[model samples]
Target: MRTGGKLAWGFILLLGIVHWDFWLWSDRTLVFGFMPVGLFYQVCISIAAAIGWALVIKFAWPKDVERWADEGRDGGGEA
Candidate 1:
């Protein structure tokens, strides 16, 4: 994959890892306590992280992904 695509994928994976429910489980009590702090804060953080990573990939490595895709197409030519 191109650099940008790889970066974007990495960021997406990271977002998934960060927002995994396992981490949130520990804070569930706080989340359901009606304080609206723990869950809300985590949601905000996850959203911000996703947006930031997406922007980084969109701007930093777009060409790399395109090149990688082109290479794949060339290598997969039909017989």
Candidate 2:
């Protein structure tokens, strides 16, 4: 894999690790005086995960497989 792909995968791994939020589990603080800190952290994590998946699709997805899948879709014979 390329360096950019590796970095993207690393970011996804970091997101996975941080999603646990063990430190925030017992916190009683409220964010913006409304949402709980833990809930806010989880919401941020959810957004990060969506962005991370998009990055993985852009960077880590196999180009050759993509080509293979598209080969037969253009009215071609054997893919």
| Candidate 2 clash figure, as a count | 0
Which regions of candidate 1 deviate over 4 angstroms? 28-37, 49-53, 56-79
Q: How many residue pairs clash in each candidate?
A: 3, 0
Best by lDDT: 2
lDDT of each: 0.66, 0.89
Task: Give the per-residue lDDT digits (tens) of candidate 1, residues 1-79.
Answer: 6676667677767776776556556564555567555577678767878786776757565566677766747455565
- lDDT per residue as tens, model 2, 1-79: 8887898899999998999999988998999999999999999999998998888888888879878876758666664
Clashing pairs in 2: none
| Candidate 2: 10-residue stretch with minimal lDDT | 70-79
Q: Candidate 1, 6: how far from true, in Å?
A: 0.7
Shift of residue 60 alpha carbon in model 1, Å? 9.2
RMSD of 2: 3.7
